[model samples]
Target: MSDSTAIFDTLKAAIAAEEPVALATVVEGPGTGAKLLLHIDQTAGSLGNPDLDRVVSRDIAGELAAGRTGVRHYGPNGEAREEAVSVFIESFAPPPQMIIFGAVDFTAALVRVAKVLGYRVTVCDARPVFATTQRFPGADVVAVKWPNDLLDEIGHSLGQRDAVCVLTHDNKFDVPAVTGALATGVGYIGVMGSRKTHDNRTVRLREAGVTDEQLAKLMSPIGLDIGARTPEETAVSICAEIIALRTGRDAPTLTAGVGPIHR
Candidate 1:
């Protein structure tokens, strides 16, 4: 088989395992069909020139982060602003993760909503009976562990595509969950509660060493201002808020409103 075929086989295996990878192919330029495969820690193949491969590798990282695919223009020897080459960068990113820190009725509802949005949802709680797979059908994982302990194991892997939702209204559960989620690089951190509960959480989070900048990252009283009442409705509101935040839209979040969250 050719070098390109070998790279393509590796790419296929990586994608099959849901591992992150990117393939940059010279589609319109010198040495068309030249390929470069990028993984998190290393690279394989080459796009003809070492300089061109290096430039496209950097661009591949950004494209992989956003899970984007498209052609990028560059001059010969990888110079910018000149279209001497067109490399199509294809990113194969794993599904975004959504870890729900409570196994309540709302958690089940949220799991369904998150899965519908292509998130790999996990339901976690300290209570074994509540955090069973039977209770949270369709969840990718059901962990009966404290929020902090669970985060300790997997927090480092979380990136901009991941989300953490602290739906446990209880102080004992919410405090550690919010704190742990904040420590990660996850894109969205939402805590579910009423205005009063959010105020109480804010104080506790502050006492727990959560800084002002980190506090701003938490979407307390989570979800959009869609007048959600039932658990199902609330789940929809929360998922909607997640999408809006990811897209950088100006939707009114529950945290931004005063008084009651429900109509």
Candidate 2:
């Protein structure tokens, strides 16, 4: 097979296994189809020159961390300027996780939406039956374990790209889940509940030693105020809120405003 084909196969396997990898393509240059595949500690395939492969692979890993995919310029010998080559570094970082700490109807809906958003979703609950894979087919992992324990095991993996959604409205589950999630540096922690429920949770969480700064990290009541009553609609609102939070955009109805749909 060709070098590009080999790189494509490697990327496909890494994505299927949920392993982080990146592909660097020579989009503009003498070697247009030339490609390089890189993982954190390993390199498979190459970009013709050994020096070019080493340099491009290192830069591609950085792009993977930020979950970015775009074109970049590089010289034929991988030097700055001169515009001898242009590489398109496509990062397939391990899919960002959406750990839902509940296996309810809302959890199923949220799992579906999370999958649609390309998240490696996990449905965790203390009850084995409720947290079964049958209930959440879309989830990457259906974990029957305590929220805190699960977080303790994999919390370190939760980074800026990941999200923790405490859909277990029950204080017993949500309190610990929220506390554990906050302990990690996860980017988004959304708690599902009504206004009153959230108020009670605030008191409980504070009593449990959640600090003011930590509390600010939470998107309590979970979703945007989209007047969504059904589980599916609520799931959409919640996912939309997560996207809005990441983009720092005001979550307003597009119908109510007029401008370019995207910026």
Candidate 3:
């Protein structure tokens, strides 16, 4: 098949299967009308030159991960900022996943926020009573399983587009949840707790074989420091933090700030 036909077919299949894919089309300057179909595993077409295709693919992957669509400029041979080519990258990404390792009241609020933000959410807790579908109606799934077991089963499916939130706060549940999530490639791992709780958990986590480098990925006291006092407000704060993380934005987080979280 021709490149155009192959790209069209691949794009349709990917979208139908709810797979992440991006299309980069040169709409201006050199190689106008050139196309490149980018998927997580492979590329279908090219943006004229290999360098152009490679550069655009990297940018496309970032846009796809963030579920964004925009036009980008580059030189004829992929040099930065020369504007010799204008490639419009259109991302068709499946909904990002947010697996919350707790079924507390805060988990329900977080499920609502994550659903509103287009995440496919899952609420998991070892307590079968707490992990009911009715309690987290907005969540896509609910599992009454241990955090480590659940993570072991589904962790391989997680990518940089996904997130894992540990809100159990209890040492028995929270520490194991954090370590399990750290093993996944999920872009965000937020743990809910206070300053003292975090300090105490850090000691336990270190003993659990969590290294400083892996511990750095934990967004303890998890959320933007917006004085969120209630569950609903904290839900918003957490969702905002996720967005800021995905877009590489600088925001004041509870993790970085000191003092009381309540105003």
Candidate 4:
């Protein structure tokens, strides 16, 4: 019935459920051995001071989002640049997620690649006939719903470790998909299209109320500039771009250059 017991139970549940969670221990601080269980939905225990808990709580968010673990120092009252407290944070992050909108040939290939890359892949399409588990066996989920509707349902769970790829190629689907993905905190948003298609889709997206700032998050003609000519090759390029973005690495993404996408 104690708070520490409840926090321990919660931590166990999170780990068992494969949810993203972190534990912060006051390893070298005024309240040594104090523990705080942190996850996207829960926070428990404290570090002997309300201010310290509040500051460490905020810092743990960034660590959990990025799946990072290490020690962070703070003043006893959570002041900056002080080593009055040393909280060692340990993060347990779930597999990163990828949601691909479209049930085209590329979708299957992308699903396969994403799975191999340890992503919990979901394939979404408004057309039920095309969006079936039979087609995308590698995907963890095959959602048959409109792009915006699906994103609205699961967008809250998408974080910096997650990605959204719009490969519908149709303006009707691509615009909504890109817009909805922009509304989320997903780290990567890639849309598949030719150079001409990308330009035309941009106009449609703008008309749909997508702002220039939001457009900046999109990687149209989605994928690395690896001269991919096949669906599997394009999938590799797309996944490579996703990894590059998450790691903040410079990559040869197609968006960097203009012209025919094939080139």
Candidate 5:
């Protein structure tokens, strides 16, 4: 088969397997229509020049990691801040992940809400009986394991598009879960509790070696100040908070308040 045909086939296979990949096409440049297929650990095809391919490949990797797609400009020889070449980098990333670290009532509601938002949900808890497929029917993964252990295994995979929610509300579970998640690149790390519980959890997280900078990343008493009392409503509030955080919007979060979650 031809080189283009081979690249197209590989791209198709990667997308079919739900793997992270990016296709960079020189949309407006000397080598228009020239394509480069970028994989996590490998690459195929090239946008005409070796230097151009190298630079675009590096960019494609970053875009894929962020689960983003867009156009970028570069000089013909891969020089930065130049616009000689316009490559359209299209990222084919798998669904973003949402790992809920509890099997509580809020966890079930969050699972359903996350599914609606197109997140690949995983319900994890140390108790096997609580973390069952039957309890979380829509979850892609139901893991009966310690929160820290689970994060240790898959934490590296978490990216800016993913989320980690700690809903255990117990210091024994929340401390380790928050500490583990703080080490990951996951964009959103939310913990559920009241203001008092949030203060206590914060102390424990600091004791567990979570730096103040990392502690700032945690959205304790997690969710928007939307008067969300029920689990389903709370799920919406949490997901909304995640969106607000990602977009850097000005939303009233539970962390911003001084008193109770609800009046």
Candidate 6:
């Protein structure tokens, strides 16, 4: 197989196995199709020079941290000046997590939507009867415990790529859920409720020591203003809001505007 094809195969396998990997392709200049395959400890393929591979691999790891994919110019020896090569670094971060803190009907819909969005979803609830693997077959996990307890156990695993959705809508449950989620470094914390419920929960969250800056991390009144009436429609709204928040896009329905569907 060609070098580029071989490197791509390796990247595909690593992604399929959920292993962190990156592919650096020489998109411009000499050796246009030259490629490098890198993992945390090992390296495969090459960009011609040993020093260039080492330097580019290290830089690619940093790109992977932010889950970025883009092209960068470099000298033949990987120097900053003189664009002898242009490498496209594609990061394959570990799958992002979706921790849904409710086992209600909305939870099922959210789990389905999250899965469709490529999240490794977990369904959590304090009640064992409500939080069952059978009830949420689409979820990767179903935890029967208090939200704070779960966070205390796995909060460290959460990071910018992870999301925590508070759908319990009960002040007692949601307060702890929001508090626990905020304590983590999760990127998104969406709380499901009407405007009135969100207003009341704000007071409870403040009492629980969630600061204004921290509360700002929350997307209360949860989904976008899509006027959704069904659980499935609400799920679409919530997932769309998550995408918009991540991409910094103003949430607008496709039918309401004109643009390329994917850009």
Clashing pairs in 1: none
Comparison by TM-score, 3 against 5, better one? 5
Q: How many residue pairs clash in each candidate?
A: 0, 0, 0, 0, 0, 0
Model 4, 1-263: lDDT tens digits are 39888888888898878888999999996889998888775689988899998999988888987789999999999999999899999998888899999999999999998988989999999998999999998899999999999988999999888999999999989988998899899999999999989999999999999988888889988999999989999999999998898788999999988788775
Global Cα lDDT for candidate 2:
0.85
Q: What lDDT tens digits, residue by residue, belong to model 2 across residues 187-248?
A: 99989886777879999999999999888788887877777788899899889988998898
Give the Cα lDDT of each candidate: 0.91, 0.85, 0.90, 0.90, 0.91, 0.85
Backbone clashes (count) for model 4:
0
Candidate 6 weakest ten by summed lDDT: 254-263
**Tens-digit lDDT track for model 3 on 187-233?**
99999988889999999999999999998888998999988888999
Candidate 1 structure quality by residue, lDDT tens digits, 76-147: 899999899999999999889999999999999999989999889888999997899998888999999999
Q: Give the TM-score of candidate 5.
A: 0.81
Models 1 onward score TM values of 0.86, 0.90, 0.74, 0.75, 0.81, 0.86
After superposing candidate 2, which stretches have Cα over 4 Å from the reference?
1-5, 252-263
Tens-place lDDT per residue, model 5, 1-263, is 39889889989898877788889999997999999998767889889899988888899999987778899999999899999999999999888899999899999999999999989999999999899999999999999999999999999999888999999999988988888888888999999998889988888887888888898888988999999989999999999999999899999998887787889
Q: What is the lDDT of residue 17 in candidate 3?
A: 79
- Please give the RMSD of candidate 5 to the true structure: 3.2
Better lDDT candidate (3, 6) = 3
